[model samples]
Target: MVLLEMSIVPLGQGESVSQYVARCVEIIERSGLSYELHAMGTIVEGELGQVLDLMRQCIEEVAKSANRVTCTAKIDYRQGVTGGIRSKVASVREKLGRVAGPN
Candidate 1:
């Protein structure tokens, strides 16, 4: 599975962008992909094409409102691997012998 971190910034919208960000997230969720909303961006887990397509959809949705939009994404494509969003962080927490809080 490919792990994607996406942050969409809608330029000229306003100081607060939560509403626009939420719209982009909705597009991703509708794709039925596994994802996590974070403080700065969203983490998505799926196949490479799925993630890329979702990114395109998100950008399109955001563009409907704002003329200038920035879609920043980082993809981790691991063959024969999955659950990177949680597992990657968990691995570090484990190495530190830390117990995570309830999700």
Candidate 2:
């Protein structure tokens, strides 16, 4: 499985680009892939090819409206592993819960 974290920014679309971001989220949602949307980017988990293709679609879709677009991505791949989108976070939280400290 592949876990990809991506952020698509459409240039010259003013200070706020939530509208474009929303479109990208729409595409991700429709892809039926497990994903998590965070403040800085969205993380999607799927086959490597499908995930890359999805990112391409998002970039092209945003380019249709914006003059220029920028995409930042981080990818993790592990053979025979899956569901990292949620499991990864859960693993961290599980470890954090073991810590004897204040929140």
Candidate 3:
């Protein structure tokens, strides 16, 4: 799985936080990948290649607004696990015949 964390700064248009977030949400939804949009960031999780492609598309869509927007996307990725870090660790424990301890 791949997770992308992005911070977008929009310039010249004085775009509200809500507007910026809404635009990002729209782009993410249009990408057809499962995503979570937050007040200051977005999280996208999916297959590596597809997520990367969609991230690029998202950046491009934001760029098209003609508002002198600049976006920085920080991506952290893991392979072969869809349920994220905890699930990955649990799977490893299961394979090793040891149950995961309580958090």
| All candidates: CA RMSD (Å) | 1.4, 3.0, 5.4
**How many Å off is the CA of 61 in candidate 1?**
0.6
Once fitted onto the true fold, the runs of candidate 1 whose alpha carbons sit more than 4 angstroms away are: 100-103
**Residue-level lDDT tens digits of model 2 in 1-103:** 9999999998888989888889999999999998888899999999999999999999999999988999999999988888787667677777877543322
lDDT of each: 0.88, 0.90, 0.71
Backbone Cα, N, C clashes tallied per candidate: 0, 0, 0
TM-score order of candidates, top first = 1, 2, 3
Off by over 4 Å in 3: 85-103
lDDT of 1 by residue, 17-83 (tens): 8998899888887888999998999989999989988888888888999899998889899999888
RMSD of 2: 3.0
Better of 1 and 2 by TM-score: 1
lDDT of 3 by residue, 1-103 (tens): 7787777766776656566667767877887776766666887777778777776776666677755777778777766657563565587889889989853
lDDT score, candidate 3 = 0.71
Candidate 2 overall Cα lDDT vs. reference? Answer: 0.90
lDDT of 1 at 35: 97
